[model samples]
Target: MQQTKEQYNTGTATAKQPSHEADQSKTQRLRDKKVGDLMVNKRRLVEVPYTATLAHTMNALVANKVLAVPVAAPPGQWIGAGGSMIVEADKQTGTVRKHYIGLATMLDILAHIAGTEDQLMDEGVNDGFDLDQKMSVPVSTIIGQCLEGLSLWTLNPNTSIVDCMEVFSKGIHRALVPVDSHMDNVAGVELVESASSYRMLTQMDVLKFLKEHASSGSELDGILSRTVSDLGVVTERVFAITDRTKVIDAIKCMRIALLNAVPIVRSSDADNEEDHKQLVNGFGREVIGTFSATDLRGCHFATLKTWLPMSALDYTETVFANPLLASIASNTAGPTSRELVVCQSDTPLGQVIDKVVTKQVHRVWVVDQQGLLKGLISLTDIIRVTRFAIVAEPNP
Candidate 1:
C-alpha cells in the first residue's frame, strides 16, 4: 500500500538547472532535449545474428528479459527481408557497421505458435500443428507479425522529445534510436547511417521520464496532478475475471480481446462491487491478481502439445480445474510473472505513471479504496495525457 504524500514536491528541481536554462518553459525545455537524452546510461543494443533461429532468438530475449530486439546483419550485407515487418532497407541507400534486419519479440513467437496447424480443438480430432518444425525456422520471419498496427520507427539522435511523444501517441510502441549514425536522404527519408550502435526507446522510457519530471512544475504538472478520474483514464468498460476462473478460459478471453493482460478479483458478489455504468467511486474493491499474455511465454513449444488443445474451440475439461491464482506461485520467477498493483480513482495521474513504470506493467487496475476493480489506466492512457498536456498544450 502506498501512503499518499501530503503534497507533491513540485517546482523544486527547476532552481538546480543551469542559469541559462532556468527560465525555459516546459515546451522549450522539451524541445531542447533530443530523443538521445532518453538513451543516457542505457545499455548498447542487444541483437541476434541475422541468421538466428526462433529458438536462439527466444533464448537471447529471455536471457536479456527484453520483449523485442533488432536483428543485426553483418557489415555490407543488405538483409533480404521478404516477410519481415520492420525492414525498410533499400540496397542503394544506407551502409552501416552492422545492418539491422528487423525487430523480433516474444509475442511474435507466441503468435506464430498459436497458429500452429490443428492448434484449435477439432471436436476430438487428434491431428495437430507441428510445433517442432515451426520452432526450427528463422526468427526474422516472425518478429513483427503481432505488431501490424504499429509502425516500426527509426529515429535519429537529434529528433526532439516532442516529436517522439507524437510518435508513441500514434500507437508506435518503440523506436530504434541510432547512435553515431549518418545517412543520405533519399525519397524523403534518411536512407542510411553509420549506426553500428543503437538504443531502443519505448513508451516505458517516456513514462519514466515523465514520472520523474512532470510533478516538478514541468509542463504537465497541472494535468498529472489532477485525480485520475479528472483525466478520464479510469476506463469503465474493462474486462475482468474472478480468481476462480479457469486458467485456460482466462487466457482465451484475453487472447480474443487482444488484451495484454486482465485483472483478477476475489469477490463473486456483483452487488458489493462498483457499477460499470455510473463510474462512481466505491469501496470494497477486491483485485487479487492479474493474468497477462506474457505469462504464456514460459510455455515451450513442446509443452504446448498439451497447452494448445485447451485453447481450441472445444477445450479440454480437465484443465478447467486449474485456477489462475493457484498457478501464480509457480510462475512468479518466470518471464511472465507480474505483481498485483492497484490504485483508487482519486490517485494522482503522476502516481499511476510511477506504478505502471516501476512495476513494468502496461495497465494498472483502478480499485476503490477497498481494493476491487473499477476501471484501468493503461500506458496508452498515460501517453495520451502526455500528448495533450505537453505536446499539444499552449505555452505559458
Candidate 2:
C-alpha cells in the first residue's frame, strides 16, 4: 500500500531553539511571529492523496493521531533543454503528463466527504456506526460538496508555536502544507493538532494525573468503619466486602440496585481497639467492575458467579464432551478479570483521565479513605463534561 507523505517523517530533530526565544511571553511572542514561524516543518506533515480509500484515510488519521492531511499534485519531470518541465502527454495515448497538482488540506476533503455536520449526526455513522460501511463515501464528492476553495497554506520551516496558535484561534483551518520541490512530487502536510482558540494549560495535565492516582493517597482518618461515615455534609456507605465475599455476589448486588459501582470494605472486627475502618488511610479501595451502560458492550461477563444464564447452550452429548466444552470449563473455572481503580473523592478530574488513559482502564471509582465507593467516573464522562464546559462558558 502507498503511504501518505505524513508517514515518512519521524519528527525527531537535533536543532534546538535558543532558551531566550522559547521563553517569550505569550502576547509578545504572538505579535512577533508569522504563520511560517509556527508552522511545523515540511517533513512533519501527514499527507494523503485524493484517491486514497476512506478506510486508508481513517487508519492513517488514527495511527498518526491526527485529523487532517495534505493533498498534492504529481511531480514534474526534467527536460533536456530546461531544468524541470511539466510533463505533458497526449491524453489519448496514455503519455506522461508534466502538470502536478498543488497541495490541499484534510479538513476540506473531510468536510466534503464526511457528510455535513447534520448528516454525520443524523446518518453518516459517527456514533458507533459501522466503520467499514462509512468509509465508502468518496473523497471527491465530499470535497466538492462541502469545502469549496479550501487551499493549503504554505508555511516556512521555522514557524513559531505561538503564531500557529494565532492561526488556529482565527478559526480559519487546521493544517499547513510545506513546499519542497527537491523531495518529490507532493512535498508534505502538517496537522494543526490543536487550535489556538482553545486554552491548554500544564495544570490540566496535572489535574488529570491526580485524578487517576487518587488511590495512592493516604486514606481519611478513622474512615475504615463497616458502617457509613459522615463528614459534615458528605456521607459514605459500605455496601460490599471483597475479602470473604466472592466477586459473584458483589456483581449481583450491583445489578439488582442498578448501581454504577459498589464500595468494598473489610468486615468489622470487635477485638481490635484500633478499628480496621479507623486504620483507613485511603488505599485498597478499587472501583472493580463498573456496570455502567457504557461498559455493557466491552465486558466479558458470562463467567461471573452471579451471571444467571438468560439461556443455555444446547448440544449433542458427544459435542459437550469434546474439546470445546473443555475450553468453556477452563474459562468458567477462572477468576473474573474485573478490577477496581479508585481515586480519592477530592482528586481533580483531569488527573483521572490521564491515569486511566495510560492504564487501559474504562472507569475510576471516587472514594473516601475508608475504601468506600463514592461515585464512578468514566472517560466518556470527562469528554462530555469538558465539551459542555466549553460550549456553555460565556464568551470573553
Candidate 3:
C-alpha cells in the first residue's frame, strides 16, 4: 500500500534528537585535563636547596613525607679573587670563570661522603659532624653523577577513572611531579590520592567489592608461593653488579636488579689468558656476583651515603590484585605482584594488616629469628576468610 506523509502519520511523530551541548559536555569530561588545572602551586610545594644540610633535608622529608627534592644551584658570579687558577703565559693573566652546574639532591651529597658515624669517627672526622662543611660542595659537582635529570608524568584533571586504573595498578607512587610542556623546572604537583576517582572508589565502589568478596576476619596463615624471604630461598649473602651482564650470567642480572641474593657465576672462564687482567666468561664477557640492595642497606654506611640504598624509600614493589585470594590471586584479576612484605615472626597480625593497609601491599611474609621466611598471608586470604564468615551468617 502506497502511503503519503500524512497517511503514514509522519507529521504527528517528532523524532528526538541528541542535544549536541549535552554530548559535548560528556566528551569534555573524559578528555585529558591539563596539569595546571589541578596541580598544587609552588607556595604549597616542598623545596630544598643545594646547600641544605643533611639534618635540615631529613627534617623536611619527615615533615612533608617526601623522598625526593629538587635542588637548584644558587645563582653565583665569577670572582677573580686571585685571577684564574691557570696561568695564560701570553695573556699574562688567569681568569676563573663560573658556569651553572644544575641541580643536586640528598642522594648526591651522600655518595661523595661514604661510611657510617663510627667509621667516620674512627677515621678522625668526629661524632656530630657539621653538615654544612660536609655537604657545602657546589651542586654542579654532583650533576650527571647523581642528580642529572628528573621526569614528571602528569594526567589531566578531568581524566576518567578507567584511564587511571593502569597508572595506579602498580606501585608508581601516587604523587606526580608537575611541570610545563617545555619540561622546565617543576612548577607544582598533583598527588594521585587527591583525584576524584580515588575518593569515588573509596566511598562508593570499594565497599561494594569488599561486601561481595572480602572476609570479615583476618587469616594470618594462608597458602602462597615461596618468596625471596622464604627459608628455602636464601637471604642475606648478596653481591652487587652492573646491569650490563651476559644472559648466561643470570646471577649478575639478579644482583643488579637487587634481588635477595644470587651466585656470581661467570659467563666464561679466564684460565687461557696469562695476565688475566680482564676476567671474561665463556661468551667473552665479564661475569660478577649476585647482589641484593638489602645487603647494602644493612651496612652502617648506607644511610649516610648520598646515594642511599633503594630499600630506604617507602615504596611497594608489588600492588594489590586479588581482593579475594582463594580464587583469583594467581589469575589476571588482581594487582601486580612484585614487592613482598617481610616482618618478624613474633610481630602481631595487626601490625601486618597495618602494613597491608597503609602500603597497599598484597602479601606479608613472617620471618623467623634468623631472618628466614616462615609463611605468607595475602590480603586475599584475609578477604576470603572474611567473606566466608559474612556469607555463612544465618539470615542476619
Total backbone clashes of model 2? 31
Better candidate number, 1 or 3, judged by lDDT: 1
- For 7-28, candidate 3 gives per-residue lDDT tens digits of 2111222234344533332223
Candidate 2: tens digits of C-alpha lDDT, residues 1-396? 112322222233212534343222211212233333222222354555556665565455544433344433344421111121222234456354332122222333333333324333323223333334545554433332223124333323344333333333332334432333221232223221111111111112222322322231112112211111121112243343333333323333343443333344444364354332122222334433332212221112222111211111111112224453344424333112243465666665445555555443445666767655665554434433433333344443
lDDT of 1 by residue, 1-396 (tens): 121121222256555776444444332455446666667767777778768888887777765666777777665455433332233333446433455656776666666655533334342124445666778888767755655312345767777777777777666677777655544231111223445456778888887766655535457768877899988877776776554454445554544555666666554465566432122222244666676655554344455667543422122223223454224324333222334677889998878887776667778888776666788887877787767776666655
Error of model 3, residue 29, in angstroms: 15
Error of 2 at 330 (Å): 32
- Candidate 3 residues lying further than 4 Å off, grouped into runs, are 1-43, 50-56, 72-109, 115-132, 138-151, 160-354, 359-371, 374-396
Error of 1 at 68 (Å): 1.1
Candidates in order, TM-scores: namely 0.69, 0.29, 0.32
Model 2 — TM-score against the truth? 0.29
Give the winner by TM-score: 1 or 2.
1
How do the candidates rank by TM-score, highest first? 1, 3, 2
Error of 2 at 169 (Å): 3.5
Among all candidates shown, the one with the greatest TM-score? 1
